[model samples]
Target chain A: MNKFREGGWHILLLLICLVLLLPVVFMISNSFKTLQDSYHSMLQIIPLHPTFSNYTTLGRQIDLLRLIWNTFFMAAIVTLGKLITGLFAAYAFKYFSFKGKKWIYLIFVSTIFVPFTVIMIPNYLVISKINLLNTAPGVALPQMCDATGIMLFLKAMDKIPKSLIESLKIDGISSHMILKDIIIPILRPSIISIGAIFFINSWNEYVWPTLILKDKSSFTLPLALQNYISSEGGTNFPLAMALSTIMIIVPLFIYLIFQRYILNSISNSGLK
Target chain B: MNSSGSKNKFLTIAYLSPTAVILLVFMVIPILYTLYLSFFDWNLISPTKNFVGLENYTSIFTDSVNRKVLLNTIVYILLLLILNFIIPYFISLIVKFFINKMKNSYKIIFFIPSLFSLVVGAMLFSWIMNPISGPVAFLMRHFGVALPNWTNSSAMAIVMLCLITNWKVFGYNFVLLLTGLGSIPQNIIDATKIDSIPRWKMVRDIVLPLNKSIAFYVLILTIVQGLQYVFTPISVITQGGPYYGSSNIFYHTYLNAFVLYKTGNASALAVITFLVFLILLYLEMKFVEGRMGNCE
Candidate 1:
């Protein structure tokens, strides 16, 4: 009887998740439809006659390879940049005492609340001045240091024992070595999860990349979709859906693989 | 301030320099520059910034379209709070307590939408909800349902945008609430069960208070950061169209600077946004620091 009730609850949860994710279902199903079929089969959760033509057509219209490369490379740079910078800054905050430390730490973490528009105009000017406009590095540069990475690192760093660090210090270990040998191994799980988050965020970033990456060659995956969705509304629906389907693959992969780490990080961070 | 050894201060500064430099160049300087630019008129390409004192601020206040955008921003905030935070909170509680099996699967499944960009969500919904050709409308037609064109009306436009963000982000807040619920002590819940307390009452008296911190974090995230997620969808779907019916303060600022080349007005709006967020964030940081404990 109890098992039956549990099964019923599972059905209920499945129904709710389906309704919530209906758009995603629609997107995936429609990506396999033909252009004419896309218009007609709007109600169907599955394509009547699925085809790969939309992808072939989309690939011909845009440089799909370059765009994917741009997005993947940019996300990688952003992930690594954020991890290194955040790890260093968080290390300083955790291990050292310095003037204006509290205020500085607060300021670093408070960048979470800094509205994006407030900085874009000046960042644009600076990017243009530095000749990084229309470059992958330009898109990656302004985004390299969000507050979540810093905060995540700080939270993870809090767990390492002070006595462990003090013993290392007494053994005449360099700060870099202490961080490398002791702190980092313990933090591997957190670093992977946080890095996944940073990567996924960078992959899906649109607004900042839209500002920096003007050339189609430098366009990220999200920016590439905007081209099909021109200023005037002559949208190529099936092709657009096909491209979106492709764009979703990496993030879904990361989520599936690192879900445990990500969930734990989120819950652990939230609890405190 | 010094650590156990005085010499390590240099190492502290060394460790801190990269973040300091990045934040200064990217966050601090841009904010100050925006404030300075807000005082003067510049076309972004012009050789000289024409100093115009408080003219930019005055125009943003006096302009009718701008006022509508401000009103739209407030509507978006309230609607977003409903769709993104409150709805997700309740749903999370339901999933946690009512669903006894595969709760983690539900979380993982729900979060799938959040993995996709809002650009995709906008496109998908715009097609799915297309009044003439959309599935929703096509189904509605059989029932003799007359659907209002949401993009045509400011109120519905804001609501629709908020819903898109909700779809993209609902799982995130839901999972957060679930996490909060999970953190409630088993003993407390077991005690409630022993007393035969009603489920709703248990949720109200025991569960809600226990999850206050996570709920607060979710609230701040939805408020301070939520609408920016709506930006891509706005640009993609409506472009704040039907006479700027759906434009928020941030989107309006973008149009002003990027489209109209009115750098001064955009800068002024940016400054105002910065000040507003700064105050809210100040309080949040104080709360967080209180919990995290004061200086190391």
Candidate 2:
């Protein structure tokens, strides 16, 4: 029974994996084909005659470096900001018990339920009123304060043994010292996981940027790619395919960099 | 000592300040403004704000086109919820089997789509579904099958949208369930096997029950994500069209605010959606927190 089960499961897993991979495989294959070939053989898994013309045409069409830099910079800033803000808040809640801590945390967590749409008009108003619209900071600012990050960090911090805190206290360590020395080090994995999640969230964010940003020069990769497709540029299939391939590639690269942290957070959040 | 206590209080307040202020300024204030705007008959460009009480909400119900939009949203949500569960469960089951043999390297590979921005996902898919050169079309051609313009047909568009969303998100679920499965003890499986439980029964009776906590989270996440999906592809690829066939309340609400500048009506729609999500989230919390085992 065990041998049979193992064989059946492996076969099933491999088959599903293939189904999962086919679209991506097709994307890469078509990227190497001429526009005419790509369209005519749209479903082809193997390109009849591969070419790099798409990549060259794509390079001529958009400022690829600026788009990549803008996206990476925005994601990095948001990830860093969220980590600092969320960590400080979590640490304060965990180490220093104060009145209304529970209610305060509750209020923070409640914000998670509020769809970002509810605040769209107001946030836009604020941005425009401050004259920060179309700026990178405007795009990145809203992501800095995250209730989910705070809550996740708090949950992780709560799991730290009280013995560690007591031992540090006996040695005359201050709460700040404990936070810096003990808590931060212990929470490294959580930080990596949380930061990766934030980076992914910020990198792929679309609507807010679409609503707030106007200038084509400042458009992130996703927005730029969107413009490319909505225009459809019927004869520019190779350029479009090239841009599409690049857009997917950036995030895919990031995922490769942080897959373990992402997978960990994915499962842990599932448990919570 | 007094200073220290006061300082701690100050630090706590400081810690809470960023999230509180941002939520107030961005979320709470926007909602209030949306509420205020919804009460007024003002185009976003107009300097004048004329208050009209409940007219927008009333109009939404009375207008037949708007009614269709509401129905379309419901259909999209239902379809998305179904795809969300089935696709992720099957993917996670596959991942679960492979975990024993390979590292979750394969799981990570599969989950790569989740990391992509919706703009990227929609565009990539648009390219893939491009009738001329898209992968889906290519595959159909290989099978000697004629491919309908999947992304252009309103009904097919929504289903395709659901498929794209599921592809990106199921990996997130797969990873989560895999983690949940990983935490389950080998001894428990041994016990189940010794009890002569068939593999399917073992999964149903033991694994499913044990993993209900994570399952609950998956449901809540899918529901919320499904509801909000309007903005991603809608804003980027479809603009909720080939007509109004693909638009949901979320996108409709966005169009009201961003395009039509009907802040008042958009606010009303957002509030309505908010209430729906709240009710669904509450139901989920109750399901997870009530009589649920071990993950507690």
Model 1 pairs in collision:
none
**Which portions of model 1 miss their true places by more than 4 Å?**
A1-12, A230-234, B1-6, B146-148, B286-295
Over the stretch A1-272, how does candidate 2's per-residue lDDT look in tens digits? 66676777777667656766776676677778887787776666688888898887777877888888888888898888888878877777677678766666656665665677777777777888898788888888766646777767876776788778878866868767887888889998888888878887888788778877888778887887776666242535556557767777766776677777667666655565
Q: Which stretches of candidate 2 lie over 4 Å from their true place?
A: A40-52, A167-172, A231-235, B93-100, B103-106, B138-144, B183-187, B290-296
Q: Tens digits of per-residue lDDT for model 2 on B156-254?
A: 888878777877776676776677777678899889769877767777788888878667777777777776754587766677887777887888888
Q: What overall lDDT, based on C-alpha atoms, would model 1 receive against the true structure?
A: 0.83
Q: lDDT, candidate 2, residue B28?
A: 67
| C-alpha RMSD of candidate 1 | 2.4
The DockQ figures for the candidates are 0.63, 0.52
Candidate 2 deviation (Cα RMSD): 3.1
lDDT of 1 at A191: 95
Task: Give TM-scores of the second chain, every candidate.
Answer: 0.93, 0.88
